[model samples]
Target: MPEEIASRRSRITPEREAELHEAVLDLLREVGYEALTMDAVAARTKSSKATLYRQWGSKPELVARALRCTKPASLREIDTGTLRGDFHRMVELSDNAQMAKDTALLRGLAHAVHASPELHQALRRLLMEPEISGLDEILRRAVERGEIAPDCPAIRFVPHMLIGAFIALPLMEDRSVDQAFLAAFMDSVVFPALGV
Candidate 1:
């Protein structure tokens, strides 16, 4: 089944695939996850629903894959020689407008995630786990450099802290946090907790 899906998906050119994913994201931004349908995506992209289903299998998988495509780069690619430097670099790399848009998209998806096991599973597999693993690598590097203790209790919570900061700002301030705000969050909350 997986091989069949892969072969079927391989029929589309990369450019076409990217266009379809972008169309999905645009629809997601406009309607939120609950209202985003394969019909809508097909209509927007001038593709067939049968093709979308053949390539992606289901709505959750399609949405998860689309969201993953939007990520700038893998966190593992960042190696700044220091955890603080890497954290700040991440903030610098993120565009404020896109970040805000992504934040809103994620917020909209949160409820849908809870209701759909397939969405939760697809998101964890395609998006969340890779990022978490990359973050773990960053923390491991910090431990290796003696910047943080090897046995530090805070290491486990770093992802949560970072995610919380991003999610909290929109809820608390009614606005998305910019690079400066995230940079300060790293210095004040994350670095201090890590005792760096």
Candidate 2:
């Protein structure tokens, strides 16, 4: 039955899929991940709950894939001859409004992630791991360029530093994380720690 459902879903057009995914994100923003339901998604997207379940297997997977749709361009593609330049280019690519929305969504999901192992696993696999690998690649390139030392202990903490700044700025200063904030953060905090 699952295989049959999967086969049927395969025939779904990319446009339709994108529409559904966007609906899911809208719902997530409106009600948050814990309050989000397949029934609500069905109504919002004009899709069947059975189809949603069959297409994604579970709530965690459905939510993860929906969130994945909102991901920015792959970080691996960023190469600006310098790590600082790459980081700045990344800032340029970000839309401040979209970043704020994503931050709020992540804050809402953070609590639910602790209570639901399936959700945590799904997000880690479908979303987090790819970004982590991208960060790793960026750091590796920096090391190769001698911009950062190969044995820099701060290398592993790069994501933490970035995510911390993203999550902390609004809480600490009641300010949205715009490109200016990020650029300054890179210069004052991240770059100094990396010894770049």
Candidate 3:
């Protein structure tokens, strides 16, 4: 490695970057995307304003990077032999605290995403695509297993339904997403939608 290359690269460690990302998400949850600031994130992470600006260039870059950090570390282990089993595992993975955290961040960003194209693309790439891909994989497997027909048009909407239910839960009932709700939802909605 060249000394000049090493000198020009960032000094922040991966763990430290994760700390900053967590701070950004937490602050986004508290203050919302439109209201969130580099100053607040700096204060929360005990980082200097100059360093953040230097590293990320702008608020969108930083927040987008933070949201990317929040995605599952990898594609979730989805093998459960049955589509219902897989859906149950995916929903159970949400738990209570994580669901609330994600919901809060999403709720905060919902308004702001429409205004900022960069942020909108970031949310789509970092927050949405992975979950969508996971659902596609699950459905693909179910199709292969003959649990459902390959030509079913309803298959495409499953991911949207899963995410929609999460977003609507707070609006419909003043409550947080938990395993019990997910379990019942799988029985009532997800199963029927899958037609299995």
Best by the TM-score measure? 1
Candidate scoring better on TM-score of 1 and 3: 1
Off by over 4 Å in 2: 1-9
Q: Candidate 1 or 3, higher lDDT?
A: 1
lDDT of 3 by residue, 21-116 (tens): 989888887778888988888888998999888667688878978887775543456879988788777766665787777777777787898899
TM-score of 1: 0.92
Task: Count clashing pairs, candidate 2.
Answer: 0
User: Any residue pairs clashing in model 2, and if so which?
Assistant: none
Write the residue-wise lDDT of candidate 1 on 40-135 in tens digits.
999999889998898899999999999999898889899999988888878888888888888889889999999999999999999999999999
- Order the candidate numbers by TM-score, best to worst: 1, 2, 3
On residues 103-180, what C-alpha lDDT tens digit does candidate 2 reach at each position? 788878989999999999999998888888988998898999999999999999999998887878878986669888
TM-score per candidate: 0.92, 0.89, 0.81
Using lDDT as the measure, which candidate wins? 1
Candidate 3 worst ten-residue window by lDDT:
1-10
Please give the lDDT score at residue 138 for candidate 1: 88
Any runs in candidate 1 off by more than 4 Å, and if so which? 1-5
Instruction: Order the candidate numbers by lDDT, best to worst.
Output: 1, 2, 3
**RMSD in angstroms, candidate 2?**
2.8
